[model samples]
Target: MQETRVAVAGTSFPAVRQHLEEMLPGAVVEAVPVELLRSGGCAAEVLVPAMCRIDAAVIDRVDGLRLIHQWGAGLDGVDIEAASRRGVLVANVPAGVGGNAESVAEWCVMAAIAVNRRLPVLQRVLRSGAAWGDPPGRSLHGRTAGIVGLGGIGQALALRLRPFGMRVLGVRRREDAELAGRLGLAWIGGAAQLPELLRQSDCLFLCLPLTEATRRLIDERALALLPAGACVVNAGRGGVVDQAALVRALESGRLGGAALDVFEQEPLDPASPLADRPDVLATPHIAGVTDSSYRGIARRVIENIHRLHDGRPLLDCVNADPAGAQASRDS
Candidate 1:
């Protein structure tokens, strides 16, 4: 029996390695860094990484590349159009609720509370032993929350926000979302409903994917629609929000503040304006990492591979083609 030959485009942490070992007992695994990938000298049939940008030139360089698997759900880094032309299969593991929903919701919720209650302002006053911080604050109860992209994460947010007694307005594909009705989401009319949602929402949470349609969905016009002192919470792709626009909104007091877990540029530079803003709270995109989420990630990746290897249906296939590379016999 010939074992499957595989390669890793490197991973962020060790749990990915352990899961890969458990999933593929005899397959060869090489954790090559991005520089090695750029060199175009290494040999591998599969490449998995947290973020790997595979363009037409890189695809040309990969002599015998078959599949590129993104460790997480987003595939913005991979050139899907070029990959489709080249017949290279790409996969993303967004199958069974990528554990990001709850964690990201938590961050957004915390941000809303922190900003509404002026927690950061109070902290500064406390440190200086100043008298009576008098920043106006709002309560979550009876407030409106606009959740964009009512997918896994958005649905989870709706569920979580319900306990707060807040009214939730959802904008999604507008197709029949069976789960949306089941979850009791008050469906907004259309994407055009965006302005109305922003106008009414005390906190606007973005849970959308970054597509051509959704990129910078919250631009100047969108930000201008928000009620005064409203907060913006982005847990999805950072490209969904225009960074410059957000900063301007914050500076102009058009928005009270923003809580961000992901960014347009990751591992944000200390010198970045967003980092320096006392009003903004930012996290380094760790909203979906925990021992449990790791296990969930492992299970989804392994199951998909199992389906592919055993002539079964591929679960959570992100790439246009799943078998564009090398197809193996059933195990």
Candidate 2:
């Protein structure tokens, strides 16, 4: 029997390889540099695209490529239509499965508070030995928190924010009355009600994935709708918010501050204006990179691999019809 060839794209997160090797002792697991993969130098039966874009070109170049599994929830980089057409199975470990959602939610809470309290300004004040209490901060209590995307992370955030005495307002692709009632949300609406949510919220939380509809969802107009001095905390995809428009809003004093964990570009360029702004608290997309999340993700990946070998259905498959691909391969 030939050993399964598993190629993990990207060099970051060495623990993924470690976990895979420990679980699948007989499999050949190797970390393929993202640069090499982009250059069409990787071939594997199973590919874990860790923060690497898997476009049609890369998909077609690789031989014996059966699966393209993302290490975590974000699959925006993968060209799903092309993968489906090529009979390649694409799957992802959804948020909340392995404490990823909770971890990200925790980060969002911290960020909201940090921005509200003018943490960066305080830090600078302390560093410069400035007068104590030079700048005042706002409190989270009794403020309206508008959560866009009501998915796993959004739901987690709502639950966590309840204890902070915040009035939670949620906007999801679809409104779920039961879920809203369960989360004790002040109001829940669909995409169409986003503007209303913005107008009422004291803080805006972007927790949705980046899709065609959601890309630049919070453009200049949307930002303008937000109450003046309202803070923004984004734990979701960076593209969901218009970076340029956000900069304009912040610079003009239309918005209070922003806490951003993800950006339009990973490893945000140091030269970018968003990098050094005192009002902008930036993190390098580490909201969901906790040990518990990775371990849960690794276990799911391993299970799917075993299922593929056993001719069973894959878990969390995003493709329209993965069985079609499996049948094509078998035939």
Model 2 regions lying over 4 Å from their true place = 320-331
| Deviation from native of the Cα of residue 285 in model 1, angstroms | 1.5
Clashes of each: 0, 0
Full-model lDDT for every candidate:
0.74, 0.88
Compose the digit string of candidate 1's lDDT tens values, residues 103-190. 6666677777877777767777778877874666778899889998877777777888888889888877664456657877666546
In angstroms, the error of model 2 at 143 is 0.8
Q: lDDT value for candidate 1?
A: 0.74
What stretches of model 1 exceed 4 Å from their correct place?
1-15, 21-30, 60-64, 95-98, 119-137, 175-181, 311-313, 318-331
lDDT of 2 by residue, 1-331 (tens): 3488999888877778888888777899989887888775677899887667889988876789989889888899999999988888899999978888998999999999999999999999999998997799999999999999988899999999999999999998877888899999987998889999999989999999999999999999999999999999999999999999999999999899999998998878999999999999998788887777777888899888887776667899887355655655634
RMSD in angstroms between candidate 2 and the native structure over all alpha carbons = 2.1
